[model samples]
Target: MERLDGARGPRSPDRRGLPARGLRRGHPPAHRRERPGDHARDRGLGIALSPGFLSAFVFPSFRRLWIGAFLSSIGTWTQDVALSWLIHTRIGDPFYLGLRTFASELPLVTFMLVGGAQADRVDRRRILLVSQVFQMSMAGALGVLYGLERLGIGAILVIAFLTGLAQSQSAPTYQATLTSLVPHDHIPNAVALNSLQFNLSRAIGPVIAGLLLARVGTGACFAANVLSFVAVIVAIARIELPPVAALGRESLGQSLKAGIRHVVESPILSALTLLGATASLLAFPLITFLPVLAGDVLHTGAPGYSLLLTSLGVGAIAGAVTTAHRGSVPGRGKLMLLAFMACGAATVGAVLSGRQWLAMALLAAAGFSLTTAFSTLNSLVQEHAPNELRGRVLSIFGLAFRGGMPVGSLVAGGLVNAFGAPAVLAAFASALFLIAAAIRLRNARLRAL
Candidate 1:
């Protein structure tokens, strides 16, 4: 057995009178040893006794929050599918689709810094609750408008913008809350579980949306999302959070500047943010253009598109699970870089594939690699962030993660119009791969991290 400090336990004599390397002599194995808060604490649930992918659930608070968030995320994905389909069918223009997506994400990139600053100054739980309420109301309004046959593209865009605005507030607080829910050592597992739930929903939600759209129309999808917020709100209210140390009030401008300065000054933060944003800009746009690949290249239409998306989601879930299982394993920085390179390579392969099966397999591999790289990066960010500035730091990270996708999509769309999807996407993937390699070669310290 190995101790927490990476030392082997004392060995005992075997039947042949030889010291057995695998057998511990004097004490129980490391996991059997008790630590603080080992007993049942919340709703009669005890801490998980063994280490694995599910280790983060040992904390009741994290478990509750995760379950609630997972449920809500599924509903959100359902709405996303239904809304996208509705826009595409109604508008019959890719421009409107791109516009809607851009409108939705713009607030997140622009206003989340303010939200992060406020998260540091106020109660995070309250911020989360209020955001949920705002989102729920927007969802309800969408359902009502659609049901009344008054839903227009402009109204949808406005609602989408408002919904994203609410998310801008909740996203940073949600990221920072993970630190309070689990011990510092378990942060990797927590972050992995977070990614796992989101990807799992991605795999499941679209199918549900499809069924609802066929049988009951888009209103049902919107209504389901509205109801989903109740679960997270209740969970947030019931869980007990540790009191935060008071941070003296600072102007939002000062707070934003401080956060940006910190990220710019720290070599690790700067590299991580740059790499993450680059991936978003280059690799993630593949997802935005998957429909083009499905229709123009593969001639597989909607069903094939759905299958490709499912493969991506399933692979991402696997990646998150693997990261969680590894926990705080050493050499994560090296592993992250390898995954980043692998994702780019797999995406390139997928774009060049002539057969649907080959494309699907490569896409799956790309998804797995991308999620592994991203989750590891997220874990490192959380580990390094100070408590007082954690929300702001994470918000900056969130911007890098999300803000690039829309711009990338627009650029890739224009390029696709000129050169075609396969050629353009392949070039982007190659760029991603080469960039990651260059970063790896130049930064020996990053490899050591």
Candidate 2:
């Protein structure tokens, strides 16, 4: 049998009474024992699924938080579908669509550093509560505008930008809280489960939104989102987080410098971030343009758009489950490379498929690849980061992850206007996957991590 360290163990003796060199004296000769570090590596990759894995999610504090977050996320997705549809109907301008993307993502680029510092300096639970309140208020405002028949493209953009700002602040605190909720050994599982919840909501949310949109109206979707935040807020109130450790005294500038230095020094992390940014720049803009694609390209309407969203969500959920079941990180570099390839191929296939069913299937394939690549990158970053700077590093990671969308939106909009949606998507997908594959082959650190 192959040994864990990529070395062969001693062979067993023949049927005769001849001893085998380096073999133990037994009928079934013992293989070389796995090194301690090898075992740890296996565990990190989710290869060893033990009973202890359950502890990551069953812990009371994390359970409440997870449940609350899942509920709120469902509402969040519902609102996103509604808002996208609303914008498509009101104004189908590609530049405006790009601006909508900017509204949702610009805050992360601007305020994520401050958000990270605040997560380290203040109470994370409180920060989450405040941010949830801000988001809920924005949702309520949108609902009111919709009810009053005063909602405009400008109003939606403004509200989206404001809510995104709140999300930027909340994200760092949310990520930091996971470490305190679970033991170190189960951190990988915890992260996977967290992703599972988000994707689960993603899977269900659009279906619900489609039903609600058909039965009720867009205003109902916004109101539902406003109400959904309450569950998370209450759950946050019910739980008690562990006390924060005293940080070493340092000036804000010094602390910021240290965080930057840490990220810069880690070649694996730096490469992962860069690769992820490129992929996001290429692939993430699809969500913003799905409405256009469904209506114009596929000759389908709202229900068709919902199906597209659901397919993506289902694919993401499948990817999350696959990761959880594997119980360890895989060869991330290879997986990432494969994911990019799959994503690119699927994108091209999606645009080319004339049949609606075929198009949805291609999109599902793309979604699965996209989510797996992203989740693997996230797990790697969290596993390797020091606790002191974890929040800051993750904030930078989030910034890279989300910030690419706006840039992609701009590029996609221009391409769609100049050439066409299919041509633009095909070109973007081809360039991105090819570049990602090249990067994976060139960067050893990215492969090994």
Query: For candidate 2, lDDT tens digit of each residue in 1-449?
Result: 00000000000001111212233334331112222233234323434334433445444455566677778778887888898888888787766777877876788668877777766777776677777788789989998999999999889889878877877777766777765565665566666667777777777878988999999999999988887788777766755465444567866667667777888898877877777677788887777788888888898889998998889878877876776555455586678678888888898898778667988998889878877776666777778778888778877776776778788888898778878777888888898778977877787767775
- C-alpha RMSD of each candidate structure in angstroms: 10.6, 13.1
How accurate locally, in lDDT, is each candidate?
A: 0.73, 0.70
Alpha-carbon TM-score of each model against the true structure: 0.87, 0.86
RMSD over all Cα atoms, model 2:
13.1
Which residue runs of candidate 2 sit more than 4 Å off their true CA positions?
1-55
Clashes of 2: 5
TM-score of 1: 0.87
lDDT assessment of candidate 2: 0.70
Instruction: Please give the lDDT score at residue 225 for candidate 1.
Output: 87
Worst 10 residues of 2 by lDDT: 2-11
Give the winner by TM-score: 1
